[model samples]
Target: MTDIRIDIREKVFPAVGQAAAHAAIQDFHLTLHSGEFVCLVGPSGCGKTTLLNIVAGLDRDYRGEIRIGRQQALPKIGYIFQNPRLLPWRTVRQNIELVLQESSAGNTVDFLLEAMRLTRFQHVYPERLSLGMSRRVAIIRAFAIDPELLLMDEPFVSLDPPTARQVRELLLDLWRKRPHTVLFVTHDLREAIALADRLIFLSPSPMSVIGDIRVPIERHLRQDENEIEAFRRRLLDGAPHIKQLL
Candidate 1:
């Protein structure tokens, strides 16, 4: 188990010829304990994804220090993007196996498939699966690698309401089993309320942490509609500006 420390002093996107540059994050300091599920929310185009990219080490042109526990080596990171980025040609089981090839975790593909209720669809290709099912496979693939840190970028976005709720439940189940240190990005305040141990709110642009609200209710209580609504109100009251975006 490894804790994370992120101290991003500044991050800038340089101008491409005539296009003006933009500041994505500035003086953004955050920390995540092992097994903590943290959610990031803000107005659209506020560089939430940019912040995830930096933490995942995909974009390194920035002035900052990101340390993971005490390990000098880079942590193994798993990412679930907005779209289910599974290979179109590969079957669901094969997609998960691809990630497992490098991992020491044995027989994880089948276990995760069953856990996510994708066992019957293991042999199906990405195109054959529904949007929700594909996303489940995508999640299974991420966890198959047993990553030290998981970064999810609106994994349930754009789905129909019912389907989105189903996926959220499935995600919660899988998360409870492993409890990997997770940083999830989302635009939905309710979804953040349902999943996060702590909700981190960012400013509109030139992203910076404006509020960090801990979810008052326990994880189990989130399933209760009344509790969910109550917590939602608490969040809005604490960060009134968030209501404007919603």
Candidate 2:
């Protein structure tokens, strides 16, 4: 059994002053085993990102108990946002190396550069790199830390379809090589279905877990368009609210 279990009891927050109190996450409970890849999908403002923030310990203002294994969930979180938040002054390798430096895990720099296919542009600054390369660098920076949990907030949202697909493939390959408990938040149902071992659907604002669907298809089949499409259709059938989002 994996050494991670997240239990979110009740998380409520005020919505910009207080016209009405909005429960960002109400009775949200999720159990994620280690080495599991879970994707969260929902309509906009459904508290998907809010839930991730709670798990990451970015926002402890809410009420809940988040635990990893027998210990309280520590702050060893790696976040990959929609934008490739890289420093313009630093080169690709330098940016990745900086993350390693924080942990004193210098050995991972080379491996991450190779894994992310950023070796060719190692010395290039963020401005010199293309959007895809910058995104890859951000991913490497996140993984370089060897985090216990990785939280991705629609990491590929800014890319074109082809670039996004490539990044997704790269992400899966890296995840396979170094398994970690991952909570990925995305609006794309197909992307979520392709990459996740389990699919979690959130309702509209003041989000709650409305559906939990296990994707039985093999992760290796993610590259197969037909299989991915079929699985996506099945997932949509299970979560009709998701279909409404489209």
Task: Encode model 1's per-residue lDDT on 1-246: one tens digit a residue.
Answer: 778998889999999999899888888999988998999989999989999998889998999888977754457899999989888988888888887765654468778888899989989888888999989988998988888899999999889989988989999999889779999999988889889999998987788888888887887788787888987887788666777766
Residue pairs of candidate 2 with colliding backbone atoms: none
Give the number of the best model, judged by lDDT. Answer: 1
Query: In angstroms, what RMSD does candidate 1 have relative to the true structure?
Result: 1.6
- Model 1 clashing residue pairs (backbone): none
**Model 2, runs deviating above 4 Å:** 15-18, 102-106, 238-242
Model 1 TM-score, 2 decimals: 0.95
Measured with C-alpha atoms, the lDDT of residue 212 in candidate 2 is 84
Positional deviation of residue 158's Cα in model 1 after best superposition, in angstroms: 1.0
* lDDT against true structure, model 1: 0.87
> RMSD per prediction, one decimal?
1.6, 2.1
lDDT of each: 0.87, 0.81
Looking at model 1, report the run of 10 residues with the lowest lDDT sum.
99-108
Across 1-246, the per-residue lDDT of candidate 2 in tens digits comes to 345566666677666765666677777778887777999988888788888777877888876687766777564889998888898888888888876664565568778778878778888888888888888889888988888889999999878999999988898889888887898999888898889989888788666777888888876777888998987777668667767865
